[model samples]
Target: MNLPHDDKTCGWYAALPPPQPARRLSGSQRADYAVIGAGFAGLAAARRLAEHEPDARIVLVDAQRVGEGASGRNSGFVIDLPHKFALENPDAQFKQRLLRLNRTAIAQLQSLVDEHGIACQWSHAGKYQGAVGERGLAYLAHFEKLMAALGEPFHAVEGRELAKVLGTTHYSRAVFTSGCYLMQPAALVRGLARSLPENVELLENSAIQRVERDGLGGYVLHGADGQIHTPRLLLGTSIFTREFGYLHNRLLPVMTFASWTAPLNAAQCKRYSGTFDWGLTPADHAGTTVRMTQDRRIIIRNTYKHVPKYGRSVDDSTRESIRAEHRKAFLARFPDLADVPFTHTWGGVYAISRNFTNFFGQLEDGVFASACDNGVGAAWGTISGTLLADRAVGATSSLLDDIHAVTGMPSLNPPEPFLGIGVRTRIRLAAWNSRAEV
Candidate 1:
C-alpha cells in the first residue's frame, strides 16, 4: 500500500538556516559503501564506515532533505532501553546485552556530538517517567526493580523527590536517569552530515527507485537523477519499507502526531516546566509526551495510527478535533496553559515491528538493513547504524548474538490483515471516551 507523504514539521532544527544544497546524483557512480536514507540509521552507518575506512568513498542518498524523515520529526529525546522493551519480556539471557548496547549507543552518540563539535544544543539532563495513577506508579516501581535485577542502573524517585526532578506536583512517582539527553533533531542531523569527511557525498532530493545486484558482489541503486553501484549497500529507510519490498512487510508504519505551543515566558515556564530533562513522558499511556525547548516552546506529541499520510494534510474537521483534544490534554496536564495558543502542529510516520523491536541484519548479498526503531530511534538508530557498519567493515562486537536472535520474515512489510480493523476500533473507542469526558 502506498502511504501518502506528510511533510508538516516545526522545531528548533527546522528553524535553522539551510545548508548548501546537496547535489543529487547526476550520473552512474560508485562508492566503497553506499547508504540509502540519510536519517539517523543511515547517517550512523555512513559515519561509522568513514571511521573504519577513512578513505573509503561513501555516499548517502535521501529522497527528501537530511533529517527530514522520522529522525528530524522526532521529539529529540535520547532514551535507552525505553518502555517498549518493558512491554516485551525479552529473554533474561540477553537483557543485559540490549541494555549495554543501548548505553553504548547513547555514549557513542554524545561522543560524536562532542568530537564533531556540532552545536545542536545537546544536553545530558536525563529523563523522568512519571506515574499519573496507581497503576502507573506500581509499574514504574517494579520497573526499577526489574532494571536493577537486570544489572541496569535506574532510580525510583517519588513524593518531593519526584517533584524535585520533574518540577511538578502532578507526579506522584517517577523514574529518573541521568543518562538521556535532548537535542534539536534536524540540527543534529544537519550538523552530523556537515561534520562528515569532505570525501563523503550526500545527495538530497534523491529517492532510491530501484535496487539490483550488478551480477558481481556489487549492487546498483537507481535514483531519479542517477544511479550508484557499490560493493556494500546499507538500507536505512524505515517507515517507507515498501520501497524495499521484503523490508516493508516486516515492519509496521505507525503515524505519530505532535503539536507545539507558542514559546512560553518565564511565568509560564515556572508553571509548566521544571528541570531540563528531555520531556515528561508518562510511564503509562495517557497518550501524550510533553517537552519544553530551550526557548520554552511546549511540544506535546502522541502516536495514533490513522489513514497514513506522511504530509500533514487532514480534513478541516479532523484537524480541528485533533487540535481540540490536544489542547484538552495539555490543559489537564498543565491547567495554566489552557488558553495558550499552539503556534505549530505537525505529524510524521515512525516505523515499528510486530514484536516492537528494531530489526537489523543483512537482507541480501552485499546489502544490509537496520530499521524499526519503534519510537526510540535516537539511541537505537545510532546503535544499529554502528553495528551494521562494524559488521560491514569486519569489526568484532558482542552484540552479534542478540542481533541474530531477531528473525526477519517476508511477512513483516504489510500491516497484519486485520490491523486496520483493530486500529479503527481503538480510534473509535478513544473518540468515544474523549466525548464522554465532556
Candidate 2:
C-alpha cells in the first residue's frame, strides 16, 4: 500500500498558530472499530461510531497531521446547492435530495462550531460566481436560469456594481447566492479533532502500510512502527484507498494548486475597494477561484494536473510552474496589488470518478468506505462519512436511503497509459477553452 506524502506547505495550515505535539502510535493496539484517514469523512465517522457505541474503543489514524491533508487544503466553500452544471441531472427530485443532504452537513458543522466556540472565521457571507469573457457570461446566464427554475434566490451584479463588489473590473458579470458559508478550513478540521468523544482515540503521523485478514473475521493494519487489530474497519481515505487494494482504476486523482499573498498594509487596504471578506468562483469550471480573506490577504487558485501516482510525481519544477500560473492569475485580477508578495504556494490532490458520482457502501463483509467527493468534499464528504458510520452499525433512516438513491458505484476507467494520455489531453483542452476566464 502507498503511504500519504503531502507537502507541508498548505496556506491554510500555515496561517494558524502552532499545534500541540502529535501522538504517534507504537507497538500494538486493539480497537473495536478502526478508521483509516483522518480527514473530514474519517473524523465524522469515528465520532459517530463513538456516539453509537459509547463503551467501545474507536481508533482514527492519519499519515500526517489532521489539518494538513486535503480537507484543510480545499478552497473552503460550504455550498448548500448542487454545482450549477450538476443541475442538468434532469431529475428535480434528485437535486432536491442532494440539497437536503448538503444543508444537513452544513447544519451539523455549524452546531459543532457553536458548541465548541471554535474560532475558524465562520461566516455566512455567501459566495459569488464571476465571469470575464463572453463564453463565461453565457455559461453564467445558463446557471442563472437553472437557479430560477429551482426557485433558488440569487442577485445579479454587473458593470460598475460588479467592480465594487469584487474590487476588480476584470469580471464582466456575476451572480451572488446567499446559501454558502466560508471559513478557515484547517482551523475547522483541527477543532473537530479536538472535540471528539472520549471513546475515540486519534493517532496522527501514523501511516498504515498494509492490510491483511487475521483469519478470525478481522483485519490487521501494519504501520511503520506498530500494528492495529480490529474486527471491523471503515475507510475514508479518498483516492488513497486504492493503496489498500480497492477501487483500482475506478478513481482519478487530480492535483490543484493555490497561493495567497501576505496581509496588505493599511495603504494597500485603503486602495482596495471590495468587501474585506469575500470568495468568488469562476463561471467556467476550468477557471480560477479568488478570495479576499478576513485578514486582508488575497488568494488565487487555478491549474490542474492528473497525478495517478498520488502527489509523489509533483516535483520542484512542477510546483514552480504552477506558482507562475498563480502569479499570472493574481496580477490579471488585481494589477493594483502587483507589489504584494505571496507568502505561500502549495498543491493538493482531489479524487473524481468518470461518472461524477461518489462511492458509498461496503466493499466487503465488515469493511465499508466512502470516497470520491468529486471536488465538493467540504459538505458532501462530511455527511457521507456520518451516514457511513450509521450504515456500519446497522442503523437506517430516510437520509441514508436518499444517499443510496442518488449515489452510484464508480464506473471503470481505462487501463494505465491510456488513462494518463486521455486525462492530460482533457485538462489541456479545458484550460485552452477557458483561457480568457483565467
Candidate 3:
C-alpha cells in the first residue's frame, strides 16, 4: 500500500516553529474506532467520534506528521460557498444547501479556534476573485450574475480601485465576497490536532502498510512498527483510499504546486499598496492563486499534474520548471519587488472526482470513508468528516441530509493510461485557455 511522504518544503509549515516530536504506534493496540489520515477530515472524524462516545478509545494515525500533508499544504481559504457551481447547474436550492453546510463547517472551526486560542493568523478579511483578460472577465461577469441571482452579497472592483486593493494592475476586474476566511493552514491543522478530545489517541509517522479482516468481524491495520485492531474503521485518506482497497477509479489525484516569497522588507512593503492580509483567486479555473500573507510575504500557486501513483515524487527538473512558473507569475503581479526571492516551493495532492462530487458513505458494512473534497477541503472536509461520524454513530440531523443531497457517489474514471492522458489533456487545455489569466 502507498503511504504519504512529505518533501518538507511547504511554505506554511516552514513558517511555523518546529513541531513536537512525533509519537509512532508500537506493539499491538486495540481501540473502539480507528481513524486513518490525520488531516482535516480525519481529525474532525476522530474528534467527533470521541464526542459521541466519550468512553470509547479512538486511535487517529497518519503516515507523516499531522500538519505536513495536504491539509497544511493548501492555500488556506475557508470558502463558504461553491467556487463555480452556479454556472454549471444553476440550481439555487442545491447552492443554498451547500452554503449552509460550508458555513456550518466554518462556524465549527471558528468555535474551536476561539475556545482553544489557536493562533493560526485566522483572518475574516474576505477574498477577491480577479480577472486579467477577456476570458477571465467573462468568468468574473458570470460569477457576479450568479451571486446576484442567489442573493449573495458581493462588491465588484476594477481599474484604480482594483489596483489599490490588490496592489497589482495585472487584473482588470475583480469581485469581493465577505464569507471567505484566510489563515495559516499548517498552524490551524496543528492546533486542531493538539485540541483533540481526551479519548482520542494520535499516532503520527505510523503509516498503515496493510489492512485485513481480523476474522471476528473487525479490521486489523498493519503499520510499520505495530498494528491496530478495531471493530470499526473510518478512512479520511483522500486519494490514498485506493491503497486501502476502496474508491478505485473514483478518485483523480492531482498535484498542485505553490511558492511563497521571502517576507518583504520595509521599503518593499511600502511599494506593495494592498491590504496587509488578503487572498485573490483567479476568476478562471486555471489562473494563478495569489495571496498577500499577514507577515508581508507573497504567494503564487498554479500548475497541475495527474499522479495515478499516490506516493510518486516530482522530479527535480519538473520542480525547477514549476518554480520558474511561480516566479514568472509573481513578477507579472509585482514587478516593483523584483528582488523578492521565493523562500519555499512545494507540491500537494488533492483528489478530484469525475462528476465533481465527493465520496462520503459506507465502503462496506464496518468501514466508512470520506475522500474527494474537490479542492475545497478546508470547510467541506471538516463538515463531511463531522457528519460522517454522526452517521456512523446512528445520529441524525438536517446537516447530514444536506451533505447527502449535495454529494452523491463520485463517477467512475476510465482505467489506467486513458485516465491519465485525459486528465493531463484537460489540464493543458484549461491552462492554454486561461493563459492570459496566469
Q: Candidate 3 at residue 310, lDDT?
A: 48
Give each model a TM-score: 0.88, 0.98, 0.98
Against the reference, the lDDT scores of all candidates come to: 0.72, 0.90, 0.90
Candidate 2: residue 177 Cα off by (Å) = 0.8
Q: Model 2, range 163-270, lDDT digits (tens) per residue?
A: 887788999999999989999899999999999999999999999999899999999999989999999999999999888888977999998889999999998888
lDDT of 1: 0.72
Q: What is the TM-score of candidate 3?
A: 0.98
Candidate 3 backbone clash number = 0
Q: Write the per-residue lDDT of candidate 1 for residues 345-408, one digit (tens) a residue.
A: 6666777665666667877778888877767787778788878888787777677665555434
lDDT of 3 by residue, 217-286 (tens): 9999999799999999999998889888898878888999999999999998888877679999998989
